[model samples]
Target: MYKLGFIGMGNMASAIQEGFINSGYIKADEICGFDLSEIATEKAKARGVTPLSDGHEVIRNAEIIFMAVKPQVVEKVVAPLKEDLKGKALVSMVLGYDFAKYETMLDPSTRHLTFMPNTPIAVGEGMILLEDQQTLTDDEYDFIKKAFESAGSVEVLPSHLMGVGGALSGCAPAYIYMVIEALADGAVAQGLPRASAYKLASQTVLGSGKMQLASGLHPGILKDNVTSPAGSTIKGVKALEDGGLRAAFINAIEKSMGK
Candidate 1:
């Protein structure tokens, strides 16, 4: 079995671990992790991960190491462990950090990859964006891709596109949650029970998303199908348009990317 090590035991790492174990793609015994917070390590241990003494211990024990630390502290955390990371495949989840920075900090020969995965990975329905620095062999790349496939759908894209893709899929989940909440609020305003409103709104969004994917049709066409010339749906859509819903979403993405 391939050994997996996580250098941080935060939410994202925990989610990935859960997805791997739940999908039967990786065994608990094959994983090790480390975190500065005792509570974080304890939580990881509760999930059957072996909690290590430090990041170096994790790097030493596992062939594939996940760098799940924050972007701000990544350099501080990884700089000291440069020697230990040699010959290992480093999978980084730090946002806005690139492979070039990793190569500059650590051994250039170190196989490195950067990926963006949303919170949905906890339920095995995530959208993951991947970019590599041409350092991994075919087998190594395939292994990493297959490992992440257990969590959700994976898309490999150019390094330059990671930022745009991350904004679209990575940050869009929060936007979607907001949309669901607003829709539910509208239902509640109409005198529906709060719980039923949330369920109805959430299921509607889920089914609509699935239909768009399965049908392979333009979303505008799909919207037209649901909208009649003189109907409630059209009226609702017009209200949304009047409220600048489209521009709000587009601005949200742009703002998320620091534009």
Candidate 2:
């Protein structure tokens, strides 16, 4: 039996498989996945994942199953496997979907978990948010945490805060990418080559984030440290403030959470 099973072999599911394999946490053979798309299953097979014929087959052969399909079709995908999921831990990566829905759709004895992991997981530098409906045992919880941590940081939050946490961490990579692009564009406007600009801008953001995490200092303080009296950094900071950068980001998160 495979240790991990995926009901969908889309991008997110592929990312998780890559992360786990790259991290040496689990070998590719330990995973089995099934997708309606033949192309997707072929891709999974190329990555050493055992590709199954259907979701029911995956559920039967794997200990832990991840529902990586779209939220709207999740019920349809799992409904037929109600019997196979009994006493198994089923993890869902669908946004805005809750554990109660899965419990009602699947067998009552099925254990459920909701996970929110971003695309960065493919690179082993992602942020993962987790919420479980009190179904995992101590060992099960630790195993799941360690599995995800191989790909990036892991935070287990109250179910009530999953949406907020998902917005902050799950949506953050895109926001950061936008910031990187804007910074690169500004550099290009100043005569820097596009490729060099992207490298510089991305590295700067990456370093700044690492510094913040390592130092445990307030971001405001870190900004202040970089902004010298009448300096270029301060000038850029002023430009951002003038453009309502902070407010724009705050609004973006609120909108993402459907607030």
Candidate 3:
């Protein structure tokens, strides 16, 4: 059997496959998947993923199955194959679906793992939020954890916190990208070249994130370190604070979590 099987070989699945191969955790030939889109199949093939005839063929031939289908079509896709999934380990990347819901959809003996991975997974810097599920064996959990850690950071949270954690890590990337763009726009307005501005803004954000992670310091402390008394940085900080940046982020997360 193949090591990993993907039901939907879209961008996310392609990223996962790339991560597995890049990390040397799983070989390309050992992975197989199916996608209705010819373009998706071609992309997967470029990454050395073996294209399967159908989702059932993927599941029947692989040890662990990853279901990356859209949330709206999850039921439609799985209903026909629900019986075939018995006792199988399913790693689901579908949004808005939780472990409790899976328990009702899948067989009692089937093991399920729900994870939220952002678009950054394509670059090996993704933050993955995995729900803590006891249904999986120790070895199974270890394999899944190591697989993702090989690509990026992995956080194991209880099901209750998955939504908020996903919002912070999964959904926040877009916000960061927007911030980077805005910073670049501000620099351009101040007469900096567009390319240089984007590079500077992007790299600054990247470096700040690395520093925060490496130093294990609070972001507020890091901010304070940069904002000196009556300095330019402090002025910018005041502008952001005055603009309600912090509150905007808080409200965004609340809205994403349906609060």
Whole-model lDDT values for every prediction: 0.88, 0.89, 0.90
| Pairs clashing within candidate 1 | none
Query: Worst ten-residue run, lDDT, model 3?
Result: 132-141
Model 1 weakest lDDT span, ten residues long: 132-141
| Least well predicted 10-residue stretch by lDDT in candidate 2 | 98-107
Report the lDDT of model 2 for residue 38: 90
lDDT tens digits, residues 22-112, model 3?
8888889999999999999999998888999998898899988999999899999989879889988899999888899898899898888
Q: TM per model?
A: 0.95, 0.96, 0.96
> Whose lDDT is higher: candidate 2's or candidate 3's?
3
Residue 152 C-alpha lDDT in model 3:
88
Ranking by lDDT: 3, 2, 1
* Model 1 TM-score on a 0 to 1 scale: 0.95
Better of 1 and 2 by TM-score: 2
Best by lDDT: 3
